[model samples]
Target: MGAALHLAHAGQPAPGERHRTKGKGGSGGETFADFARQVYGDQRATPLARELLLAFGYATMVAHSEAERDVHDVWSTARKAMGATRTGRRWRLDEAIADDAPRYVSSKDREHRVCEAPRLRPHPDGPDDFRNVRGICGSLADWEHYALEKQLGTGWYKYHWFCKRHLDHLARVREQLREPNERAPQPVPNRGGLLPAYFESDWLGTYRHRLDSPTWEPPVYGISADDWPTPGVEPVAPRARLRLAALDGTLLVEADRGARR
Candidate 1:
């Protein structure tokens, strides 16, 4: 747990220091470090929420490791910055992209909206091509038929999207299928030595193995082959390597390089 070990004391600002910044007062002015601290302290946030936020905070820290200011596109930035390391850029292929959420909320079709313009599909041969993968507009699918998967488990997700009426019926059916004595697992906070296990076992473990291998092909949605660091070719940055070390279970190293206060 290199830098995430003692996150509470590492280069943190004083009690009143965070509020002095010029921006939206309170949380809006807060840095990723400040936001992480608040999430850790908030008793109301669920364990799942805490885990998500902390992981995001760690990703943010790694993304802007060379910069002092926070970035707006933390996810995209992190994907690019960590592309060369053993972490690879793909987070989770099964998780539904939040950017695609708004379309599902509207009663009317959003396909014709000025903002929802048609985009080119990835090249058939590969994402990387001499044409830069640019192509003609494939027929846009209708907004009404657009569906997204609901993740159920590892390598598993709902096969089809359901309407509200069908979802209500399915909810009842699912409840009936559960045993009377069955109980859901209680969620635990990913802190006080628990985070390292969860991070290593689930979060980083997902893509770390693929990145460590040599024969990996660049996925259309993930980092390109050019971004992959070749052995003895391009040296991996210290920040890129720090994320993997931070989640090590047996290590007790000092956490010096952390997000700015």
Candidate 2:
């Protein structure tokens, strides 16, 4: 039997089944499965809360691939540099700012308040790097967090922060990144007379249309039958053709006169 079939025969517990195993923190800790059950079993736990707990459990239990591990390592390094913990900790903006100068001032009152912002990614799929994280004003952050919780139908808020403006900007950016087919089709302008006769003209007009033809006329200024160059009949200029190599080296294709046919 295949390894997958053998593992299947081994009889692993269902997702909702209560079982204890090593947690994400390390070995011998409270198991994710048990933790998930505890969260689900609680009467006070909301549906969103249960889902969030379950997602965390699922993420922890799944083994990371080599590429995933590499990404995780980079994210870990960035988090460490920003003084963030594995279990999310709130960071004070005042600590990073100088006593004389503040990075941000309140738009409402123009007061310098010490904002205790949670170290969070701007969006769910945003990079784990510190550059993507924003530290909004304290009152604004609290209101935003509350609004998010209400919208999600959960008491627990995920570690993703954005003020109204930032949130709207991210939404617009995401919309722009969506596939062309996924986006709503834009209305095409009706330009009945704007198009040239060659484009909208009948078969006879298209076939008979020529630069020197008496029936043909220049649609735009600075263009006429006398200005149109005759194809194959005119003496063409011998221009040097250049080819670029993979390593940034350029090769002149028409270097040798004898090589040219």
Worst 10 residues of 2 by lDDT: 1-10
Q: For model 1, where is the 10-residue window of minimal lDDT?
A: 96-105
Q: Model 1, range 159-231, lDDT digits (tens) per residue? A: 2222332445335544553542134221111112222222222223333342343343322211211222222
lDDT of 2 by residue, 33-120 (tens): 4444544553323354344334323332333211113323322332233453345553221111111110111122223222334434
- RMSD (Å) of each candidate, 1 decimal: 20.2, 32.0
Highest lDDT scorer: 1
Candidate 2 TM-score over all chains jointly: 0.16
Give the TM-score comparing model 1 with the true structure, all chains together: 0.19
State the displacement of the C-alpha of residue 13, model 2, in Å, after optimal TM-score superposition. 23
Give the clash total for candidate 1.
0
**Number of clashing residue pairs, candidate 2:** 0
What is the lDDT for 174 in model 1?
A: 49
